[model samples]
Target: MTDNRVYLFDTTLRDGQQTRGVDFTPADKIAIARALDEIGIDYVEGGWPGANPTDDRFFSEPPALKRAKLVAFGMTRRPGRSAENDPGLAGVLGSKAGAACLVGKTWDFHVDVALEIDRDENVQMIRDSMKLAAKRGFEPMFDCEHFFDGYKANPDYALSCVKAAYESGARWVVLCDTNGGALPHEVSEIVAEVVKVVPGDHVGIHTHNDTENAVANTLAAVRAGARQVQGTINGLGERCGNANIVTLTAILGLKMGYETGVGDKGMKQLKKLSRMLDDRLNRAPNPHAAFVGDAAFAHKGGLHVSAVQKDPKTYEHIDPELVGNQRYILVSDQAGRSNILARFTEIGVEIDPKHPKIQRLVEDVKEKEFLGYSYDTAEASFELLARRTVENVPDYFSIERFRVMDERRFNARGQMVIESEATATVEVAGQRLHEVAVGNGPVNALDLAIRKALSTAYPSIDGVKLMDYKVRILPPPPNSDGTDAVTRVMIESAGPDGTMWRTVGVSANIIDASIMALSDSLTYCLLKSGTEAKVDA
Candidate 1:
């Protein structure tokens, strides 16, 4: 490792699994380990081996990493146990990882209350654990758990714990803000003091996000001479989370000019890696997350959009492409013609600012948005609207009529069940086809019925699948509907080849909005597949 290179230690599989609803299987751990290696992370902490079967199985057959060192995490030996005989220590050795991280209580309060052990014994624990790990042929690292709070309470004891680990041959002694209560300035000052004894090159920083300052604190530690940063993907951990490595990587590598293993090329994979974790967990990505979020570089206001179009540095801090994210211009009621043109240009639709169709499309978008359509999250819908206005796409089929009904009844197993059925009549190739299908919900039934009606004529329709659906209720539009609310539906669809697209619809009736979006999703898939124009033209 270069002297200026800050090592990235990913604890997503170990600390991140402490997240309440997160439970990564053995395979999930292996897959994530490989992704981290591919991204060139210096250290990948697999998990605590002896604690659970999943982690045990993972260590038993860890993936063959190309670049990253697979590190196993565990605690130091218990109060009275010898390090050589401790099961936890043995498990770490048995893991066969090239490196091992042992977390020990650095806080006097924790040593007195949590472990009920003498302070001297705790120091011995840290010393013995590091010595044994090194003797076992693993690169030993010690995590000074609660180091900041411990330093504040008893600076001498915390410093002694760190010294013990270093004197015992620890390759790295990580200062952990276990409670995540340290402010940036405090972290800088504390780390500065700690490094006086253990050298900055041997220091690392691990922080939680309870106060939402984990990222800030990590950077402060780095500025104070820490060389290694420990965090998780998307900040996954217990409670608020650990520091977000994705955000930290960008700031350290791009902003601070620090060298990380994830150089320019690996930085481009940051967004994809973040999204992959969310996808595997079936969780939605935070649109506003720094660096990798959907709206990280999105501009909305007219003035901001105009300035960004000229010079992105006016608003954006860094080039979004550096982190594999793109700039987005949102068209809303606040949009000027500049917003419209910028949005069109982004979607590859060339429209002059003064074109008559530009004003028409902008007006239509504003009017529809007033009726509860959000173009920002539904760019695919806006693109279809623009395409229809500039050069009308061929109508593959037209809906003659449709109906959906829900019936609650007892199944043959005598269990109560609610079934939804939909029937649709569509015109295709001058022939009318009527189809009916039952589904779990009204929208699903409608989707099934429409696809059944068109699949025989356009076999390509069979390849489309509705991947996700979201519904948001908005206040009734002004003066048009007297009802209590209107519904906006966003549908995410996937093609057979794994291409995904999103479409949006709005109406006073939930089913109506769902059907509109669902139909648009199918139509968009067909258009992209180049099969819409081939259907009995």
Candidate 2:
């Protein structure tokens, strides 16, 4: 608990909500805000009060506010109207937040271009907004819009804008490189220079990633004396995307020794949170993220695994365990016995260096890998392989034969409809069950048959549901018309507990892909339920 507190302000609900294709409902805003608060963020900028009904309602609603200060963000009063009557400015005073942030045009170009007003009038607009905020007893943060580019184009006008806000009693003056194209070196020097010419108590950096340098520029700003940093969750913002808090928190906490969301969870949650957001948005997580990404702690080279086994510090910067991450000793064409043994040891299974079983398993894993089977993404497949030599695995259900029908017209139908039929069997405690089911597609048919056949044995499985499935085609080199194409499938399952895991399957036949991925999903569920799973196929 270092008292050296740098406040965290997220505009995800405000600016982030404005990202194209993003529309966080009042409920969505509340949920994300609570999560951010629980993670130790200082402020959650909800939204502009008068701008939309959802935001205005968010400000008025009594949602839980645990650790974050709720802030209403908006612009200043209009030029011709009184601050009290200007609905936009008045909404700032009317919102649920005790504090409000007012952004005003600071660039001479914006004045003449976006606003079609003169520099003096733009300065007056900022002055009036700040004064109204102060008179209304609100903590005012002045966002000097495009301040960096403004200063570059016309330093005098930008400086004049800063003076207007200060003279009118702004609490914090944030420099916005709104275009997000500024480099780290430029931001560092610019902020240091800005500090010299203005009061520096609450100067903040609000940057985007048009140049993919928002995180770097923020770190440089912090090193150069900017007191506050602002960005978004998963960096969801307008244009090329705003600064990603995932990268921001990591670099700041790990590289710069700053305190952020808790350390242990912070490191682990980086990957989890990234994937969590991606899952909600139906997007794939980047395997290349730093610290907690899938590839972050992955080992491939045999020498590297051997060295890391002795001391991971030889290749890794820090123990990934601190962040809830685990080291992976991969088994691929690149593996040596050491890599295989290292991986086995992590899972509580140790093998002799020269054991016959060890060599066989390693070669088998590598052979399948060369054929496009990646255990890294196919945890269930690996589990199956591991169990083959381990112990007996229960078969809750096994597919016998399945059939699907789709036609523009059918004998039994006046109109056209696709039909599916599947048959499966299961043996539980010496009693066997054979069942048939129908669904819309091959995967759906299998899901139906398995559920029907296994219902008596695994009664709790009625709660399981397949949430998503992703498929890719890998055709053999000499294939024609996709005859020899390998269809890879990844299935996501969720249950009553809200837990999720992805299972992968690959085969030349589409039915095989579905069945394999489904089998993996069931095996994972069984293992998770404290039932020992032995995968036979």
Candidate 3:
């Protein structure tokens, strides 16, 4: 064996934090790093130590990663300072991280303009920083920023920078497409030339997605003999983003036959790991993203579904299960009986394929969707609808009525303030309960009121919390004003046991829609709790 393994280096906590509107607290970094480590990444670049309070705090109390080496990122020593005395170098070398990635200017243009220093001094900075890191017992890595552009502008000087780091005991020399404009062919050719001086095993590739070819360029570099791939989960980074490590991991294992730290078991967690990153950021996952997207293996066309029914290979590139994803037979106007049965299987429901209610459920789903209810995004709600159509579902509770009021007035300090209060009447466990609660907003007030009403009947309701809420306004029916357009609300709730579910509701009024979704959320939570109690009993 020639050892065709490519190391996975994730910089989501460092470079990804540069993305606009992205600011990772120390806790976020720790959680993300643990998830990356659990997925068998080789190196997790924590952040720039001492650069920001969050990064400083994260490095101070970093998570205990079992497999991945925590690396701190920073610039090389400055022009006037010696590596041993440089405060920046000291910050990186002093961090609890086991490795350091010191980035230095590679482009002559940047050296002449950005740093305004001599080219030789820049190369010396690279050498001195790596030597100091090695002396401090840290695995040194050199991030050659703008390496591709620098090589195009001045190949000799660019080579000198990487050679100095590698010669001074840097374990890996990463070539970065800092501007993200390098094409795949250019990446392959440049990497091929670089490997002649630096061994292929010691070279790494880092790219941004400005050209939308970061993943392709990374694969091209790998084909040209680079052994390490630096990227972020879900392509998270500044300036359009970086190559998606999730997609690269799948392609490397399944498409290219290259071994990675993430083996078969970790490979299966690709979809979950991608979604976890988005969840931490409180952003919606891109449905069309490669490999792990919701639509990656979804078959919506009637013709496609018919072929996939016979053989999944007809439409799917790879088994969705291989990446912790499942095939989706989207029920729509074009859906057939095959689609409904496949969906039943996907949702873990067992019913006769010829059951008459199958058609009824399909009809109901289409009807509700036409009214602006999206089952694809609200699988919990869809599951309830499915069960209700085929079998009876336990009505844990029913809301008699609910009302919310918002009041704005001047407080004791003469400062204006706004408060919302909600009152709800519900029947649960054969008792009608009425409760009132105040919250920061109307939705929160309603949620609190409902929970208070159910306190005596269901104590477990206290453990369930709302994770996220999304609202979208759909086009109103003809003759209706924009303010009266149909509103859709989706509520994501998490149970005490770490299980999460999504429910949805749609109505002309946003408040009514929110209450509908909230009701579904509570119902789903109770249903899960009751099932678990049964299992425990």
Root-mean-square deviation of each candidate, in angstroms? 1.6, 3.6, 3.7
Q: Identify the candidate with maximal TM-score.
A: 1
**Model with the higher TM-score, candidate 2 or 3:** 2
Better of 1 and 3 by TM-score: 1
Ten contiguous residues minimizing lDDT sum, candidate 2: 528-537
Error of 3 at 18 (Å): 2.3
Q: Across residues 476-505, which tens digit of lDDT does each residue of candidate 3 receive? A: 777877776799999989999988888999
Selected candidate, larger lDDT, 1 vs 2: 1
Q: Over the stretch 39-58, how does candidate 1's per-residue lDDT look in tens digits?
A: 88999999998999999899
- What's the TM-score of every candidate structure? 0.97, 0.89, 0.88
Angstrom error of the Cα, residue 112, model 1: value is 1.4
lDDT digits (tens) for residues 254-335 of candidate 2: 7677766545554656566666666555566666766767788888888999899999999998777655567877766777
Q: For model 3, what is the error of residue 68's alpha carbon versus the real structure, in angstroms, after optimal superposition?
A: 2.7
